[model samples]
Target: MTDLSNAIWRKSSLSGSGNDCVEVADDLPDAVAVRDSEDIQGPALTFESRQWSAFVSGVKRGEFDLA
Candidate 1:
């Protein structure tokens, strides 16, 4: 399991506008952690390094729309 005790999570700056933005923690040795910014005590999702890379690429390519 990922050790999130020291993980640093950050949400989008626009989250102040009341959007339910998700927060992500980088710097994990082999994976990335994601969770709902609005629910800090909620369950988190972990993704392998490679999978995270692909997901990010897809986001940049507009395959997913944040809006």
Candidate 2:
């Protein structure tokens, strides 16, 4: 497991004023960390930089859009 003790997390810009959005940390080397904004010390999902980029692209393209 990567040591994320110094990770800098940021909430998505698309998020509303509420704190119901997820947080992402890209300060890690070669990997991106994603976790719930409400659970800062909770479990996090880590993905490769490229994988995270693809996911973000998909989101921007509405690939996971709900009806």
Candidate 3:
């Protein structure tokens, strides 16, 4: 498991003060971490940097959007 003790988590500006969004921390070397904003003490999912980049790209392309 990746050590994210020092991870700086941030939610999207679009979240607009809601506690229902996911938070992301991309400052870790070679890794990115995501966790539920409403559950900061819960487990976080970590991803390889490249993998996270690809996922972000897919999001930008609406690959995961509901039809």
Q: Cα-based RMSD of the predictions, in order?
A: 2.4, 1.3, 0.7
List model 3 lDDT by residue over 1-67, tens digit each: 8999999999999999779999999999999999999999999999999999999999999999998
Clashes of each: 0, 0, 0
Candidate 2 residue-wise lDDT, 1-67, digit = tens: 9788999999968898878989999989999999999889999999999999999999999999999
- Order the candidates by TM-score, highest first — what do you get? 3, 2, 1
Q: Quote the lDDT for 53 in model 2.
A: 97
lDDT leaderboard ranking: 3, 2, 1
**What are the clashing pairs of model 1?**
none
lDDT for 43 in candidate 2 is 94
Using all chains and alpha carbons, the TM-scores for the candidates as numbered come to 0.82, 0.87, 0.95
Task: Quote the positional error of residue 15 for candidate 3 in Å.
Answer: 0.4
| Candidate 3 all-Cα RMSD | 0.7
Best-fitting candidate, scored by TM-score: 3
The per-residue C-alpha lDDT of model 3 at residue 32 equals 98
Candidate 3 pairs with clashing backbones: none
Each model's C-alpha lDDT?
0.89, 0.93, 0.96
